[model samples]
Target chain A: MKKKAIIYGVSLGPGDPDLITLKGLKILQEADKIYYPGSLFKSGLKSSYSLSILEHYKLDTTKFEGFYLEMDLTRVKVNELYDLTFEKIIEDYNKDLKIAIVSEGDVNTFSSFSYLLEKIKKENFNVKLIPGITSFALAAAENLAPLCLQNEKLIILPRVQTETELEEALTHFNTVVLMKIKTVMNVINNVLSKGNYSIYYSEKLGTTHQFITSNLEEINKRDIPYFSLITIKK
Target chain B: MKKKAIIYGVSLGPGDPDLITLKGLKILQEADKIYYPGSLFKSGLKSSYSLSILEHYKLDTTKFEGFYLEMDLTRVKVNELYDLTFEKIIEDYNKDLKIAIVSEGDVNTFSSFSYLLEKIKKENFNVKLIPGITSFALAAAENLAPLCLQNEKLIILPRVQTETELEEALTHFNTVVLMKIKTVMNVINNVLSKGNYSIYYSEKLGTTHQFITSNLEEINKRDIPYFSLITIKK
Candidate 1:
């Protein structure tokens, strides 16, 4: 009987296949099966960033089985997704199948991998996290500025949340990274205006459609996307 | 005559040759001349990480024209280094030659590149920043933990000054990354203890001698090196 079943929570660095780490690529090549979160799109494909890296490795998703989870962040839904994924792992455990679960960014940061991690730990399955290039790092890279200076404090908050959370993060941090800017641009812009923080907005960093602007007023006038990031440096 | 001369701020990621990004590699390959920060121990030799990647491409340090900066960050030494490097770039600019300035990590993060940047901006030279992987990302990857959470705030501070700054950072941030830990471990440890934060320590992340420990008590017993990092998760 196989005594150990290894699960790798791999981060596919910000949307670029070339940006994926050598270690991440190595795991993708070696894993007996690769699991990625599927979307609710009509075609039933995985997320765009992870799919690119997986395709770069010549790994055919059709060949290996995939587990789909609803794109919801509520605790109950997240827990359900993990439970289902864990059950699949348990069934494959006796066969000594090594599984790789790929996340868009670093596994421990705003990733579904955390939920799975909790479930796996409860089931006594051994799991390891493989970190990758985060969108924040990529956005900073595109801007040619440091995200957080030597003594600078940085706050990373989701933009789709309540305005109170945004205001608190803005006031407290030396550098604030507001993710998912499309959903709450007006509120974020109003907060930025009130705080007197200059904004650097980036969309699709590293891709052909990548747009970066330091003008907050100009950004407010444009249509922002879900993947856009806004940085306010103090 | 070309009105603009390109200056590349290249990141040689985390002491590994292959870890450099495709864009970073392209800049190195295409640059008219490559300049690296020089060390007293080995003048004109490429940094170990840069050398590794260059070797794969059949490029030798001896083949490229080299410039050395012997500026120390302590006291007023950094200014002298900046002046000398800036003068070299100015000379090249006068000659209509484009230059590439490479550093070990991302150009803007806790790097000497900023000093040079200040000088260049003062002189009004056309400059472009090329991003590379930072040690923080590598450290996180080596430890297999995410550096920042979904809504969590992060603070990155170098131990260049007093502990009061660190304490202030801790009070406002959820995650704190303390760089240059060798010189200020005692003060940083005190702050971590006072804050009641769990600490993760990584020494020489990504290299053969890499060591990571979450046991703060054990960390205190070990001699922390220059490459060591202390992360406080609140």
Candidate 2:
């Protein structure tokens, strides 16, 4: 009997195709099937970074499945998506086929793929993770700034409840990276102003809409997209 | 007059020759000259990574020059290296030739190339920065782990620091990456024990001496090289 092939969760990195790691590109080329998450109304086009690799290599997208995972989901809806994706993956596994599930940035960072990893692991399915270039790296590169100073502390946080957490992070670390900044810009700006830290903000880094700004007041004046980042340097 | 060809700082990422970015490879192939740091030791090897790239492309290393930086003080040494390198680069610029300076990882992240950029800017030299794969991504991929957690915080700091600094970083962030871990294993271990965080250490990631260990206590029993990375996850 053939040993069951494993499922590889790969990060395609930000939008630029070349930023994908050699290992990531190799796995994408070799994998039997590629999977990406999408919404009910959209195809995999929303997460086109992974799609570009398949399209560039002229790989077959017919086998490319879009598993639905509602962004705003109740517990039941989340479980339903998980069950459906898991069932599809297991079906492929039983037939001695391998799958590559792609994420935008590093698989472990702010990725929905973790829920799937946990579901598959519970069923004893072997999974491998391949990390890739992160948006934070791209943002820092575009700004030509160091993420952290020598002996200076750093923290990267997604938006959390309470301004206290944001304040704590800002107070404790010399540098801070706030992901999903649209919702918490006011709180972050207040903290930055209070702490007197130099601020840098990048939106949709490595993409066409990518913009970097140092002025938080200007950032507040405009409505920013969901995929935004703010870095505070003390 | 021909536009002065721009200076590009390219990072090859760790030690894998193939891991060099497509953009970086293109720059290297087209650039009239390549510059690397360090002097010819008693051994004739100029640069381990640069030599590998040259050998792979069937180019001669003798055509390239080494800019040696004296190790007296950090800022002064970096300035000296940059001044010397810029002079050689400007000589080529006078002939309307482009130059590419290759570093080990993404040029903006703890890379010596940043010093060159600062010097060039101060002297009003036109330059462009081409970002490349960072070792953090490579190391995370090698370990098959995520560098940061979703909705959690991440902190990156150098291990060559006082024990207090390390403790402060660990205390504040959900995930912490300590680069250059070889020399400060004892201090790192002390912080790990005090903070009660699990340590995942990777040495020479993507290269031969690459090893990952979660056993914090075992770090003291082993010898670590300069390229090692340690991740403390809460």
Candidate 3:
């Protein structure tokens, strides 16, 4: 009988190649194949932050195969994407190969791994996750700031969330991290100004083009990228 | 001109030795001295999970010195601890030695690093932080679950927070992570039962004695350690 393949959902950490956990690297190195998110592939593997990490460590990627998984959440039906990915994963598993689905930041947080994991649990293949540093945590480190104090709360909301949701979160939590802040720059600026909160913004954390600012005015004036994150403390 | 020393606040990730980022490990290996939280020293470094990680990775600790910094937030005056630690750090910096203040999980999350940073900001020494995988995130990974949906909010609150604060948080956020769960387990259990939330609990994550369970009843029947964490989905 052939051994069933396994899936390791790996979190690559916040954009820095060096930040990938040793266990994450070990799992990637030993895996039969590594699958990267479609977003990273579009940027090219040579320049991709995660792939750069493997190169920096002088790991032998030649022996392991790499694959790209496309994710168009807005346009594609979510279930279809899950089904296709699950099929692809099981096919590789049937061949007795260990597969890794690599995502930026921790695998369980707003990650593509979730979609696949949700669909694949009924299958016979073994699945596990390796966590990594989160982007908001990295942003806090970059600013030399704490996400929260004792008895305080932190709220993390995606950019696609309603402006009302953002405002409510800011009012309730000690620190609020708004992820993917490209389109809501003005809305966030307004909230920060009205709430009298300390604002820190960062885009593509740990990358060469990474941008960060504590100046609320500068953030309002600048063109925030789709990958930008804003942390507010009231 | 005499060079100034610096301190690196290293996030050691959850309990797993292999989970420490490569950058974190590199800094730890190269630091002239390493400072561990007083709580861990009381527990003994030989048995401490973080030290075990270094040993597991075969990093030579003999060449580098280790210092213990006392921190009893509940019993002692917090400022006095901060003042003493700041003085010790500056003395090391004056000798032009790189020092690392190691903390479990992310340094910016309810970490002692915050107090030190607040006290030592005006000093001549440089300070930087290295982010790590959080126990709550690791617990999510261990359960093969996601912390939140695309736009769902996540709340992280320490145990000292009042029961009212937790209830307020549960009403506001889609998911809530309660840290230091030993004292508040009953309150949390009551909340879970009332709110109809899905609960996942883990203690000493990544350690040999680590225990995790999705069954709320199992958790209620047992003695929850001070290091325990619970992630709830409402």
Candidate 4:
């Protein structure tokens, strides 16, 4: 039997290096090549969340294939880049190379890797996704509570497009988790002020830069980070 | 300074022993005493999911404190038992012992550890929750899809009280995760049949006894296990 060649979508958890599962660690260590998302920074610096995790664990950086992505790129251009990257993955796979694409937090929930995942499925490639601890779940853990209790409903929204959406969710669900709320901070805070709800805000969870506060006032004192999330428990 | 006693709500992930985070494994190994839930089995065979993970990893069972709880116990009796368990944990803490309460899956989401958590807080005890991979997330991974894509909403319900709950959630959210559906299986099936959504049902995910399928016909061929869950995606 020829060596088993496969692609693994690895979830490295929120931010803590120690938060990675044993299975995830094993795959990263065993893989021949790894695909990591590198974000373009000022002064031409390219850094990726998933890549930082691999470096934190002192993994072999030589095997990493960083795909530096820019936020300003058009939807058509981004797909073209992903398609080119997929071709590279397929070329290596056919040569019997094990590939791993690293993703931050849980891969299935609001992940940029979804673009590549769709391509992998369309081409009928062998893929396995290793689940990780979600940032919102970690926020709840840091707040010393779970999202919901018995018979309670929990809804997770990416960002509130309208105040009514947030208000409607708050009315129906006992616990509401809002992710990537940087743009909708004012709108969300306004609706939340009316309800006697407890808010736990976390930014860059599990990493050295992790911030956690239950007071919304303390949160508004500064500009929220792109990664910031609010978990509202009633 | 005092030796610094603390209670850790350790989440052991879904079922796979390799699924536990490095931090969670470290705490369990370094704990002075570990509290595990033991369930009564046939022919006096007491077993626990959390304990099984520890034993499978060959951890020291001598330091284990088994708290055998029956499901049919009254709510009052359950609270009374948790109170008694809390007292024992407190006594050990006062003596400067690090206590860990092992919970299968994430400790916060639909966990029995919540009962102990309330007591730990009311009496003012130092506690930390180590987050873990949720079974539903793992189920989604096994299904090769994330729960939701960009801007899509996700709702999680624990055993629907009525058919309307499931129907309403499906109408509003892009993805619906129903947990502990054994009690409300018929109602859920009835509502799901009318929709054009795909269903992925998983039982005992990440374990050697794991079962997964997207086909509703294959799932209905046998009795669903208590640990079973279905992830509905549009």
Candidate 5:
């Protein structure tokens, strides 16, 4: 039986190329065209950490297209990029070509796939999202950390805007997972010193330069990357 | 260099055998023994949904061991099962055999690994947790729904006991993910009728008996499974 022509969005998982699920791997292979996100530099060439993971698999490069997502988060710019990306996807969809949209982490998580999905809904496009492993899961796994246990509340916040927010989570939840802490490290540092807690930190996980640590001082000594995450457990 | 022998805990994703990460698959194949969890019926036979997913891959059954975990959550019984399981793992560890402890979803997320991990800490065991695709991720992916987005708080609660708590999350966070909703269908059903919010419900995801829907009424029509989950999005 022939599978119907449609668009599929797959998560590559975090870092290690081998983390990609068999279902995601199969969709990537079967798709006629694969679209992935990348940051376009001033030189007009794009570089994508997500694409670099694919290098391990060494999939056919001819079928892949990189959507140059700029670093600026201006609403107009962001909307334009996704809108244009959808335009190209619709073209392929109209031709009955199978399309795969690739994202770095779980497509359901805070990833580019969400923006694309919103556009997909408006057009009534046939799309399937293949779930992938989340970075936080891998980060906790590598460190032998429990994300949350029986009756434990897990709050995954993108930012710890204030010390109060961090403190509230620390007090109320059994475990707090804070992501993209590069800019809000101060709030975390203050709360850490004020309480008795265990810290597990990972940056650029699954890559060659990956860093993992339990010592807060060790992490404080270095510049935290945007991909860095910490599980503050009590 | 050959990968060194260690006790590895790998998540089998939710239901689909193919949803297991490539790394998890490789570890399971190479392990000297693979241990999974299930219930031992009065008939002296065991049934495990996690192991059933493995049947799709059709790995060697001889290498598998099913630990009988009672339906009861008594701490004494729970401790006994994991303690004995760890004892055997240690026996294999002493023999320098590579071992894999299998769980259904992400090992880091509210699974038996946390209980086993507590036991491992008593003795220095060379162990690694290989994260797997989470069922919630699969649930969201299937519905083209976003678990969370920029600056949105994502609260994952095993129980939403009160209407106030559910309302709080839906009001503050962009998305609230509730797992194991089988027991709390009444509370959910109450909120569904009161609000104009969107609901994405999933049960036995990626399995033959999988149920998924955005319609709250359709869910009320059937008996909710224990594995069911819901995401209330405002």
Candidate 6:
């Protein structure tokens, strides 16, 4: 009888390598193989946030085989990616490999790793999800504002698809954190204009290129980046 | 001219010493003074979660001067505690100290350190808030559930005061994380029963005394503790 391989869902924590938890860092450094689910943007490998964080920390990646789980959903079918990932993970499991899927922020928090983990977990492989510092928390610190005080409600809208939902969330919650608002910024800005919410915007938090602005007017005038986050307090 | 004291807000990260970020750990190790905002429990000094995490990590406490910012609001007036904390901080500033306030989880996310930082920042002191892994994130990972799917809304209700608020939040958001639900567990449980939501319960996450349950029935029957949290997916 052979032992099944263990899969670790490691969170890199925002953009700073230093922000990665000791547990996460340990697993990343000790993993037999590292797998990063690259974004569907320009170049999948180039936009791999986790790999950049690992490189920044100067972890010896050459010691292990690094794999990029590139799934361009827009260009390829979802089933194709799922089947490919399923087979890849199963193959590793047969080899008794200790694989880690590096994710941004907490692995269980609106992460792409969630989809892959679902497929991996079905095979009854040993899996562990290591939590990390969330980007909203960093954005809150960058702006020197509490995400929510005592008894205050905080709504985290990863992507506000509808204007109606945005209006409702803004009205109901004490604080609203809008993530990945790049594509829908125009619509979000319009809905935000109708409300009397104080906004704090941050892009590429914890990185050298990090930007912060408390002025909603400034955020409205700028070209919002893909990684940008907006915090609105009522 | 006297140099202002530098204050660092260090987050301990979800009650696990290993979960502390490298940046937070480094600051904790090098801090000249460590100040922990004690809880109003049995003993102010004994109930410091950050201190326990430090001890768990086997960090030496002999090198630095440790201070307990004992602000028991239940027993003492807020103004009195605020004044005493202010005076103590100012006195340290006079000595040109580098004090670190050890906070649990992200300092900017519903932490008691926020109040102290507000006072310290007003005095033009240099303060830095380092982020950490939040308990809810850990709980989600423990239950192997995603906090928020691609476009799903997530609401973090730190302290749910009113039943109406809980109803609205659960009804609107795809996921609702209710923290510090000790007092309102019965009410929340009653409301939770009405929805077809899957619940994940965790108490003292990442600590040795940690508890996790997917069964809402068991959670409802048990005595909810102060450190307990409930995550509901709609």
Encode model 6's per-residue lDDT on B1-234: one tens digit a residue.
Answer: 566468888888878789999998898777767776654443534456676788875556763443444454453565566667668767777788777878887787777777887887788788888988888899988888889878788889876877888898877788989998888876787787777888899988898889999898788787778889999887
> lDDT tens digits, residues A78-127, model 1?
56766777788777765787788888766766676666776666766767
Go through the candidates in order and give each one's DockQ.
Answer: 0.39, 0.46, 0.78, 0.83, 0.85, 0.78
Question: Candidate 4, residues A1-234: lDDT per residue as tens digits?
Answer: 337889999999998988899899999999999998877754687778887788877678788898877666677867777888889998988988889998898988888888899888997888899998999889989988688777788999998888999999988888999998999998898998898998899988887888899888899986899888999987
Pick the TM-score winner: 4
Q: Which residue pairs show collisions in model 3?
A: none
Alpha carbon lDDT of residue B6, candidate 5?
Answer: 82
With a 3 Å backbone cut-off (N, CA, C), the pairs that clash in candidate 1 are none
Worst 10 residues of 3 chain A by lDDT: A39-48
Worst 10 residues of 4 chain B by lDDT: B38-47
Q: Residue B131's C-alpha lDDT in candidate 4?
A: 93
Best by lDDT: 4
> Which portions of model 1 show Cα errors greater than 4 Å?
A1-6, A41-47, A60-66, A72-74, A90-94, A119-128, A160-173, B1-6, B26-32, B41-58, B63-76, B87-99, B118-128, B160-172, B194-196
Q: Give the total clashing residue pairs for model 6.
A: 0
Which regions of candidate 2 fall more than 4 Å away from where they truly are?
A: A41-49, A52-57, A119-128, A160-172, A194-196, B38-50, B53-64, B68-78, B123-126, B160-164, B194-196
In terms of lDDT, the poorest run of 10 residues in model 1 chain A is A39-48
Task: Quote the TM-score that chain A achieves in each candidate.
Answer: 0.86, 0.89, 0.85, 0.95, 0.95, 0.88
Model 5 RMSD in angstroms: 2.2
TM-score of chain B of each: 0.82, 0.85, 0.85, 0.94, 0.94, 0.88
Whichever of 5 and 6 has more TM-score, that candidate is: 5
True interface contacts reproduced by each model, as a fraction? 0.44, 0.51, 0.88, 0.85, 0.91, 0.83
Can you list the residue pairs that collide in candidate 4? none
RMSD of each: 4.2, 3.4, 3.3, 1.6, 2.2, 2.7
lDDT of 6 by residue, A88-165 (tens): 777877888878888888798778788888887787778999998888999988788888766777889987888898
Per-residue lDDT for B4-73 in model 5, tens only?
Answer: 6588888999888989998999888888889988886666677898788777776888889888887645
Clashes of each: 0, 0, 0, 0, 0, 0
Candidate 6 Cα errors over 4 Å, as ranges = A40-46, A63-79, B1-4, B40-46, B58-79, B161-164
